[model samples]
Structures are given as structure tokens and as C-alpha cells.
Target: MTVMTTHLESETAEIKRRRDPFLIILWLVLVVFALLWVAPIVLIAFTALKSNAEIMATNAFTPPETVAWSNFSGAWERGNFATTFQNSVIITVIKVPLGLMFSAMAAYALARIKLRFGKLLLLFFLFGAMIPFQVMLAPIFTLVNGFGLIDTYPGVILPYLAFGVPYQVFILHGFFKAVPKELSEAALIDGASHLTVFRRIFLPISLPVLAALLILDFVSTWNEFAMALVLLQDRNMWTLPLGLMSFQGQFSTDYGQLNAAIAMTVFPAVVVYMIFQRYFVSGLTSGAVKG
Candidate 1:
């Protein structure tokens, strides 16, 4: 009976020991922030369900009178999402891999090869990264027109590749430099070329950084609007952002349809984040250890 009583007292102490007030407070704070973050999304979802008249007639926080799901299908059709979505997918699919490959190659050379003036060249790329994209629009437009790429896929794609490479190379260079030199030297002694070393040694270890860059580039290219607006003139060639412009009339806007379109357009990037979120922190940090 004494042993049982002692065991009960020990269990109660253990339970109290496991509880921390600061941890509970921290969690409560996090919960508040999380709710604050999700509140916008929830509001947008509710707004998407409302009619245009209902939206203007009621309070912003009011529950939508009806869950008008047709807004999605209507927006899909009226916005011509089929073609715009296709263009975005093609651009993302081609650009992500192409950017990564080229960036990785350039980064490897800059980080590992000891090329003459490599720092100057990296400075050039960093300059490109720092430049205001809006300032480049006129020159880029002229170049695109001069090359006869106006309203074409090449027009849109080339700019993405050019801008995409610098930041990617910047991040990847740090990562490549962080890789131990002896490993590559060992590979070379075993009859491996630089190409083989890159493929077999460097890339395998650099997956997290690469994944983070991939997600970042994918989201940026997918959501790009200003450049797309200037380059693409034909309605048929319009990407998702341009297609959303169709919902805005000079006088009035289709708020329900507009909100629905936004949700759909944002869905892919959100899904990509969810998939790669685990790798993101490690990827961004591990590359910086040696840099």
C-alpha cells in the first residue's frame, strides 16, 4: 500500500514536471499568429463564395449568404484558364530544370574552378540580381522586339532564364563552395571528370539547397505578372496573371470571380510549398555554413 501511494505521488510529480508555463504561453502566441495568418485565407474563401452584389451590400466579415460554387467553374471558363494555365505549366516545367542546370554549372565553375576574374563575373551576376526589374522593362522590351520575339513563348521564356540564373547561381555557388575539396580530388583520382564529379558527388549532397531554389524559382516564375504583361500582347498567349486582368472592367469588377481565380492561381504554389517545406530551412542554412 505504501508503494502504491508513493507511485501515485511520483506520477503526479512527473506530470507537473512535464508541464512548462512558458511553453504553453509560446504555443498560445503561435496559435494566435497562425489564426491571424489563416484569417485572410478564410476571408478570401468566403468572399469567393459571395455574389458581386452581396459583397458590396454586406459587411466584409459577414458570412456569405450562399456558397456559390459556380463562381469557380465560371471563372475557369470566362478567364480562359485552360490556355493560360497551360502556358504557365510549360514555362515552369522548362524553366525550373533549365535554370537549375545552367546555374549549377556556372556556380560550380565560380565556386570551385579558381577561374581568373571569377569574382568580377560573380559581381556582374549579383548586379543583375540587385537591379530593379521594373527599370529593365524598357530595354528588355526593345531587345525582345529587336529579336522579333514579341508575343511569343521565347519572348517570355528567355527573360525568365536570364533573371532566374543569377540568384540561383548565387545560392548554389555558396553550396558548391561549402562542399569539401578533397572529395572532388578523390573522385578525380578515381578517373572521374568534372562533369562526373558534378553529377555523382556535388549534386547528391546539394539536394536540399537545390530543392529550396527549385521551389523559390517555380513560385516566382509562376506568379510573374509585370514582365508577362509587357511581353505578351495577344489574348491567346496571355498567362494566368493577364487572364485575371479580364475580370477587371474599366467601371466594375467581378469580385467573386476575381477572388476565385486568385485562389485557383495560388493553389499550385501553395501545394509546392507544402511538399518542400521540410527541406527549406535546412536547404537555405546548410549552404551558408562555409560561405
Candidate 2:
């Protein structure tokens, strides 16, 4: 017993020695990475507070004489953010939930439930992720025009759903495969339908992948510029990304207001990630472990 105690003590000391430096190194790396990420946001925050003259005359890196708190308001009004923001919200609100439900359900059906063409359909969707949206622009434009969705919210929302579904389904299908068959089998044994099992078992277990995919979809749809620019011709139908173009002039542009507009645009995506970040890592890992 005395020999065992001494051996255990030595083992504990050795572990401490190994762990301390590794932890220090990890923390240092994290701090450096965090600084790199925060630097741009800090620059944007400071730049957004400066006057246009200040941004032009002085180096962009220079701090402003006074923080122009009104820059946000100026950009908001000049950019007509109210209208564009409403359009984005309308698209996001209507798009994200529907996209999530459809994709998750499709993934569950493909991964869990039996289907004849499951592999072929999944391959088709996975193939879409490789296809650039730009490549399909002309055809998609013609289709939207034929459907009379031009310059309308449905125009953008529909395309967003189309693009979002394939990728999200790909993610969710993998996660659903990771879920223990026992859970679904047990539920079915108790007379639960596929829909009931999906809601209770798969949905709860799949939260992480859901959160991560939701964030990805939200950010992509929020920042979508090319499709919005093409589909939406009316100023009233413009989303924030399209409306940011309003700040440009023939020869000169308001750098301060542009930066302010950008900061506003970035804020929501950041907030969304922050809210769902806790689930992101777990979701990614859980899918892998289960599989």
C-alpha cells in the first residue's frame, strides 16, 4: 500500500508537469487567435465612429478625435436600412424555420426511414454543394421571371430555401445516422409514427447540428448579394446587402458611412453565432461520435 501510494504520487506529479505547459500553450494560442479576430471588429467599431473627413484625411488606423455616435443613424437613414432590413427579416423569418424543418425532415427520412432512391437523392444534393450559385444564375433568373417572382420577397426567399436545403440536409442526414437506432426502434415499438419519433428522439439529439446549420444558413442568406441584386430591382425590395450600394458615388464614397453600414450588417450574424456557439462544437462532435 505504501509503495502504491508513492507510485500514485509520482504519477500525479508527472501529469501536472505535462498538463501545465500544454494548458499554457493552448491559452497563448487562443489569445493570439482571439486578438487576430477581434482586431478587425475593433477597427470597424472605431472607423464607424469617425467623420467622413476624418476617415479620408487621416489614416484609417488613427483613432477619431471624437466618436461620431451619429454615424450609425446617418448610415441607417442614408442607406434606407429600415426598408432593406424589413425585407431581410421577412426573408429570414419566413425562410430559416421552413428551411430547417424541411431539411431536417428530409434528412431524417433519408438517414433513418427507408426510401428507394435515398442514396441517389443524397448524391444529388451533395452534388449541389459543389455547384457554384453563379453558374446557375442565368437559368435561375429565367425561372424566377417565368414564375413572376421578380422584384419580390418570394424571389429571394425561394432561392435561399433551394440552396439552403441541400447543404442543411447533407449535414442533418449525417447527424441523424449518428442517432442510436434503439431510440427510434423503441419509439416505434410504443406506437410512435415516424413524425412522432422525429420530433421526440431525433430532434432533441440533433440540436447541435441544427444550431450550427441554422447559423450557416442565416449568415449565407443575410449576406447574399448577387441573387438579391439580380432578383430585386425595386429599391423597396432591396435587402441590406443591396442597399449598401447606395453609399457609393461616381467619383467618391463615404468610407465612414460604408464602414458603419458594414458594422450594422455584421452585428446580427455575430450575435447569432454567439447565441448558438455553445451547441456548435457539441453538435459537430456528437454526429461524428455517433456514426
Candidate 3:
């Protein structure tokens, strides 16, 4: 009994000695980052509740003496959020799913199906991902103008879909490629067509990745600015970013209302992330490692 107790105590000491300092450093780093990220958001919330006069007098981090609840309503009305919010919602709702579907289909073809010149096509997509959107702005504008799509949702939506697909396809392709070949082979042996396999097997199993992409694509669509600014000439057709831009005038800016609008703009995305966050980490890391 004495010898057994000594061995058990030695094992506990060994385990304690083996505890990595790297984990402690990692957690400390994570906590610091978490606080860093949360600070700006908290500051924005604080500023949003202040009056413009109060904002001008006090520093950004200072809290309001009294919560100015009207700032939210004022932001909604003054920013023309009613119209801009609808336009943003319309673009995001239409663009994200369509982009995901198209990306997923392309990824499936590239990763699962044996296609002619598949490597070349993938390289083409990767090249497209590297090309900056700023470089394409002139050509895209001209193309949209030629199609008479300017001042239209299709104008902006089409461009968004095109730009977003390359990266999304890149992400989904990796995840799809990592799927077990045996699973696909078994399905094929059971008389399942490629399309059937994709729809039934791949799609169901890829929910985490799909949800992750959906959230990412949704936020990108929601916050898109430059293309929307150029394509959507009509004021009523403006999206949230454009609407937010209106807060800054040549001579004067409404900081409080601007911050309020910002808070509101960020709210939907926060809600979306919260809802889909469970799948986010898993989805991103899906194909990162292999046994």
C-alpha cells in the first residue's frame, strides 16, 4: 500500500510537470484579444447613447450622463434607414444564398467530379481571388452600364456574386475534397447519380461549412460599399454603407447619430453570428488536417 501510494504521488507530480506553459500563454493572449475586440464595440454603444452636444464636449470612451434613447430613432429617420435598410436586406438576402449555391456547385464539380482541365479551372479561380476588386471596378461599371443594370439591384447583386464566388469556392472545395472517397463510392455503387450524391450526401454532411459561408457571405453583402455606391446612383436604392456615408457632410458630421447608425448596422450581423457560431470553428477547420 505504501509503494502504490508513492507511485500514485509520483504520477501526479509527473502530470503537473508536464502541464504546458504554452497553454497558459495562449489563454492570456486570447483574453487580451477578447478585451481588445470588445472595447471598440462597447465604446460604440456608449457613444451611440450620447447626444451630439454631449459627444462634442466629452471624449469617445465617456458614458452618457443620461441615455439618449432618441438617438436610435433619430438615426433611423435621419439616415433614411427605412429605405437603405430595405435595400441592404434585399441585396444580402438575394446575393448570399445564390452565391453559396453557385460556389458549392462549382466546388463540387472541382473537388468531387472528374472534370477536364480541372486543375487549370481551379488555378483560374485562384487567380480571380488574387485580383483586387479595385482593379475590376472600371470594367464592371462599364459592363453594368452596357447591360442597363445601373441604379438596379441586379447591377450590384451580380457583381457581388461574381466577386464572392471565387473565395467561397476555394473554401468549399477544400472541405469537399476532404470528404471520404469511400462514402461517395458506396453511394455510386447503390446507383446514386453524382447529382443525387451531391444533393443528398454532400449537402447534408456539409451543413457546418455551408452555415459558416452563409454568415460570412451575408455580412460581406450587407456591408458592401464601393460597388453599391457606383452602381446604385439613385438615393432610394442606397445600401447601409452608403446610408452611413451620408452622416458625414462636408462641413459638419453627426457623430452621435453616426455611431447610433453603426450600432444598429452591426446588430443584425452580431445576431447572425450568434445563431451560426456553433458551426463556425468546425467549418473553418474541416479540411485543415488529415489522419
Candidate 4:
């Protein structure tokens, strides 16, 4: 019994010793990555607080003697963030729901339905994923212009939908395909119509994927600049990204104000991610496992 206990104790100590090195290495790697990731944000925060003169005089690595709380307020007003924020909200509200619905419906059909050309359609959308946004800009702009949608919200929203839909479809299709067909068949046997099965059965099981896709789509639409710049010619219709660009001029740049504006622009996305992070993580994990 004494010899057996000694052997087990030695084995346990060996296992712990082996684990310690890996744990130390992992923690060191994480710390280095954290510092690298956080460095830019730290710099942005410091720059936002400093006056232009102070920024020029002092090393950017050093913190300001006094935090410029007013920079945020000033940037807010100067950037016309109130109006730009409203525009972003409107575009997001309209585009996100519509995009999700269309993408989900298309994905469901492609995944579940039996059709001669369904695979072909899926391949076509996959091809779209490989095409760069810049490649389609000219043709897309011309088409929007021909439709008299220039300088309008629809002009920008429509293009966003067109570009965003293919990706949404691709992601959701994999998720939908992974869902057990037994549940769907059982629902149909219970006299549930196709629409009812989709709404009541498929949707509930697919919430994780849906939530993940919504967050992804919202972030993309919120940060999108190129389409907004090209489509929205009017100041009133300009989204936050386009409005923020107005802060830069030929003569001089408001570095403090620009940093402040950037911080604010980034704030909403951060807040949204925080709020939905739990669901986002769970959904992504679940989708990956199931898919």
C-alpha cells in the first residue's frame, strides 16, 4: 500500500509539472497578444484627450496632463454625429432585418428544398463571395444611377443588401443543412405547413446561427464606407463613416477631434458586441459544432 501510494503521488506530481510549463507559455502568449491588441486603442484614447499643440509637443506614448472630456462633446457636434448617427441607425434598422429575412429564406430553401437548380444557385452565391467589393462598384453604381436611386438611402441600402445577402446565405445555409431533417419532417406530419415549419421549428433551432449572422451583418453595415460614399451624395443622407471623413481637409486636420469621433464611432459597435457577446459566442460555437 505504501509503494502504491508513492507511485500515484509521483505520477500526480509529474502531470502537474508537465502542465505548469504549458500553462506558463499560454499565459505569456495571451499577455503579449493582449498588449498588441490593446496598444492601438490606448493610443487612440490618449490622442483624443490631447490638444493639437500638446499632441505635437509631447510624445504620443505619454498620457495627457488633463483629460479633454470636452473633446468628445466638441467632436460630437462638429462631426454632426447626431445626424450621422441617426442616418446609420435608420440604415441599420432597415437593412439588417430585410437582409436577414431574405438571406434566411434563401438559405432554408437551398438547404431543405429539392430543386433541379438549387445546387447551381448555391454555387453561384459562393462565387459571389470570392468577388471583391471594388470589382463590382462601377457596375453597381451605374445600375443604381440608372434606377434613379443616387443620393438616396435606398441606393445605399440596396447595394448593401446585394453584397451582404450572398455571405449571409452562405453561412446560414451551412447551419440550416446541419439541422436535423427529422424535426422538420415531424412538424410536417403534424399538419404544419412549410411556412409554419420554418417559423415554428427551424427558426427556434437555428436561433444561434441567426443571432450570429445578425451581429455580423449589423457590424458590416455600420462600418461600411465605400458604398455609402458613392451612393449617398447628399449631406443629410450621409452615414457616420462618410460624415467622419468631412473632418479631414486640405489645410489641417483636427487630430484630437478626429480621434474623439473615431472613438465614438467605435463605441456603438463595442457596446453592441458586449450586449450580444454571450449569444454571439454560444451561437458561433454551436453552429461550428453542428455544421
Candidate 2: Cα lDDT at 266: 79
Judged by whole-model lDDT over C-alpha atoms, candidate 1 comes out at 0.84
User: Per-residue CA lDDT of candidate 2, range 1-291, in tens?
Assistant: 211222135877878856666556767877999999988877888789998778778776788998887888988888888999989889988999899999999999999877799899899987877778977888888999999999987888889889888878877888888677887898798888999999988888787788887787888888888888889989999988888766554112666777888888878878998998887778766554454
The Cα local distance difference test for each model comes to 0.84, 0.82, 0.85, 0.83
Clashing pairs in 1: none
Question: How well does candidate 2 score on lDDT at residue 200?
Answer: 84
- The TM-scores of all predictions, comma-separated, are 0.86, 0.85, 0.86, 0.87
Q: Arrange candidates by lDDT, highest first: which order? A: 3, 1, 4, 2
Once all C-alphas are superposed, what RMSD does model 3 give against the true structure? 6.2
Q: In candidate 2, which residue pairs get closer than 3 Å at backbone N, Cα or C atoms, i.e. clash?
A: none
Taking the tens digit of each residue's C-alpha lDDT, what string does model 3 give over 162-193? 99989888888898998889989998998989
Prediction 2 global C-alpha lDDT: 0.82
Specify the highest-TM-score model's number: 4
Local lDDT at 52 for model 4:
81
At residue 38, candidate 2 shows an lDDT of 83
